[model samples]
Target: MRRLLWLTAAALLAAGCSAAPGGEAAADKQPAPRPLGGVLHHTAAEAAALHRAEEREVRECMASRGFEYSAVPVGDGVRRRAAGNPYGLLTRAVAAQDGYGLTVERLQRHPADPNAQRVSALAEGDRRGWEAALKGTRDGPREEIELPDGPTVSVPTDACATVARRALYGASWDRDRYTVHSLADTIVRETLGHTLVRAAEREWAACMRDEGYRYEHRKDPLEELEKRLDTAGSDPAALRTNGREELRIAVRDAACQVEAGLAEQVSRAQEQVEKALPPARTSRLEEFRAAREGALRRAGARAASTT
Candidate 1:
């Protein structure tokens, strides 16, 4: 999927550059911002609702096949799994305390689903059959959907995931929007890799050094903390020490970012990319929004009907 999207973006940029004035050099100079908070095909609430509807379908599908199942509510944990500072703006409060949230334990741990445990207790052959029914075969037949002027992507149609998606988004909805969202993500990644952003990162690194920390990039502090945690292993004392050092470094990193104006520079570059996207890409974005809204409405209706 990643390779295909990159190829699509590359093709679009190549075509766009040849037709535009000054070619690739001028196009590279243009500012392109990645979507703020990442490209969400569905909002958290919408996704959660869709998941609930899907879970219900899975339960019914299993029961009809002579197996019991339970529907679990997809709540905060599922929705906020990818929550992070996508905009490069880290608040002082967040940095001073959480420090990338490596040390902080999750407050809402997901309890084991009883239905899964019940499934596990079944006879080996029956359990395998139930699992296959719910998840479909790993090497099963697949349905391929192609993007407009892009590569074709395949997905399993005989799984619970597909059932839920079809109920909420209708057939081919995933394929239609996949390219649009993936292309937007590629633009953001390219924007971050811009020379101007790299220069700003150097300035940020310099500020971190002045604060008595040697780091090359904005993500270095968290990366260092992750390494330390891995080395600490099961040692509580070492973990605590590492956690404290991480908080201190994180606070300094956020302060340095402000002093060096790194966030502002990155944001500016992103805005340029957002403004410079070709009309076709922009149209796809609009289509993405409409598809999302329509899916949400359909998902809501399905959920309400089940109740």
Candidate 2:
């Protein structure tokens, strides 16, 4: 679900240029300072580096096994992927350039995976070998890990993906995945639903209505946009029109987020909510965070080496 009710954030962030709601005292101040540190924390730069490193690992591994793989750039396909947290804080540059980033995603020429073309082009047996090598034998001792929220997920010990994680996140990669994968949204929801954030939502909703978008909840416009997009189908002109409309709605949403201090509210609430979690979960979160930072460092090094 859209980042699990971070409202439009189920999608992100804000830097609104319009006049803010508060008077001179508020106007004199900048946006509220946000807190740092969470179970889910990765700046866009770190994320991009990690993405590149992981893709390189998988690609190189598959090549060693006599298969072709092309690392896809970060896109919508990756955004909602399990175990990823791209729910970036909104900024003015972000809103003006990308809105919620979906329009750019929608307009892309490639699918979620560039390698889909290669896989489709392969002979059946070759394709099976490729899949097996990348994912490993599903029935053997090395199967996917089971989690609280979903069915068993494969991070097959024998697979390229698992190898990539190991290289980037060290031996605790599996444990790290287990800790953070299912809880990303859970954490996001708790933070967003905190009292402070709830109040901020009310103000944001009011601001949206004032802007002529009657969205009681932040995700409303996105939901509406999706439904409207369904009617557009594949007509180029229709898609372009919808894209433009999406940008319009998103720009306003970003502005409203700023006027309401939603981003700051969520960040602060997240810090508080995380502090209140049970000790066991808290420990696991700490472990996950350590792994993430380690991975970022490794990924950055790899990126530099390649350059």
Candidate 3:
């Protein structure tokens, strides 16, 4: 969803130069502002809780229709690790430790969700029916549901997925709240593309070049590392070798970001956008936050009752 209003603690620390050793504060560094906290957005934990609630509803809905279903628990470790680096900030300390997180090896070992595997193991005819029931009609004319706002959203009304969402988010959930959240996030990203931020990115790229790495943007180093990881796949020796290389590159990348002041520049740009946002946009953000909180509360209560 759109996530413009908050910066993770890691992002905040990195941007403020508080997380890195020997990092100098830029002369024009704006005052680092704290994020709006729980009021402005849902935490990763809250999102995962809501997802689990939805899965539970889907499983129950399928069971009531005489099909077996399972609610696969979400991986807390993955969520925690991802939230820690939401903006892909690769500090020297983090690089020395994780090195792109063994994502490729983990995925190779567990290619499909356990719940999905259970569904797939059913007889072909039964599987077809279960899939159709869960996902709605496969070959029907598409339909659109309009939200209270002036926007139309599409969903498969005939699918069990729709039922799951309705159960968790109420019958009137048209995803308008999420749409607004997405818009706010887009504003931050677009602001980062402004001239001043782009100049900082160029300087960061040059710094990386001097360190013997060819990268154009702050995200490029991680992206390239991921590609290498994917190529290494499940081979233990290859993974270890590639992972070490990734750590070295990531450490250099983080150093360059600090040296070129990219984090500070991006943070300032984001702050400017947040301050200059129009009243209408701000109103939508509040609405989104309220809706998210209500959904999470309901989901948590439902989960508690079921247990």
Candidate 4:
């Protein structure tokens, strides 16, 4: 069955960056922006503000449509609970302990969801209607978005969530809205293609070979580990064996990343990529940033009013 929009496992991570589930801000003051590689990221406070504003808009829209919608507030611990670097840029010591960090992710406990409880309490027919209201009819109008590195996905155009997203970001937002949240593979592609970065990567590969691991690309280690893990599923003995091997490979991979200067070169390549972005792409990114800031302001105002 099509689950309710913004419910399920996603709620644990989506519920908060700095605010609890209601319209209230978790922190009184907004936090500064964070950096991802060279890109600017919203601080937890800013994320919570935007989420608080978006969810409130969703709730109001649902109420107008004669449905009960609960606003899932961003909890301060949402992203904080997850351990390990998603990018796999681990230090030698940490890598020796956590491996590709997938083990920690596998064992991470999920938080409770009020929305799930709400949905569970509803009649089957009512649940379907509720999902359709919040997420739109399955066969309804959808806007197709092409991700930089992923398959195209269709987003409901007229759902309460869509309405809220447009209200917060801008009616003109579609692709830009996706770029704000999804991976921008465009930059990664360009960065990796840089002559210097490629050379550094070759060196990293050689370093790996020297350490008794042969991989042509940086992602190979995790991909290989994941296949072994898939085969080891639900088998304690196999998992333990794999886990031990993973730590050894991870430690070497991480040390090689630093020793080969791949990390440094990638940083340099990213800076170059950021500077050399085509005017059109640069314009789009700037527009997205403006939309983000505009929503943050609205969120701030919304939080202030509730207080």
Best by TM-score: 2
Any runs in candidate 1 off by more than 4 Å, and if so which?
Answer: 1-47, 64-66, 73-83, 105-113, 145-153, 275-283, 298-307
The whole-model C-alpha lDDT of candidate 1 against the native structure comes to 0.63
> What lDDT does the true structure give each of the candidates?
0.63, 0.66, 0.61, 0.66
* TM-score (C-alpha) between model 1 and the true structure: 0.72
Compared with the true structure, what per-residue lDDT tens digits does model 3 show for residues 77-99?
44435334333445555544444
Lowest lDDT 10-residue stretch of candidate 4: 26-35
Off by over 4 Å in 2: 1-39, 63-89, 111-123, 143-154
lDDT of 1 by residue, 105-206 (tens): 322346567677788789999988888777778788678876655578787777665766666666656665676766666666766887767888898899
Off by over 4 Å in 4: 1-53, 71-88, 91-98, 111-113, 120-125, 138-154, 179-183, 235-245, 272-276, 300-307
Deviation from truth (RMSD, Å), model 2: 6.7
Q: TM per model?
A: 0.72, 0.75, 0.71, 0.68
Residue-wise lDDT of candidate 2 within 1-307, one digit each (tens)?
2222233431333333343345422422444233225435455666677888999999889889888888878754443232222333444434544556554555554547887887989999998888888877777446457665557766668888777778778877786577566665556767767899889989988998998988887768767877766787766666666665675677677667778877677777877876776665545666777788888888888888988
- Higher-TM-score candidate of 1 and 4: 1
Residue 70, model 3, lDDT: 73
All predictions: root-mean-square deviation over Cα? 13.0, 6.7, 7.7, 10.5
Q: How far does residue 275 in candidate 1 sit from its true spot (Å)? A: 4.3
Report model 4's TM-score to 2 decimal places: 0.68
For model 4, how does the per-residue alpha-carbon lDDT over 58-104 read when each residue is reduced to its tens digit? 99988888788888857634333232333335555345445675544
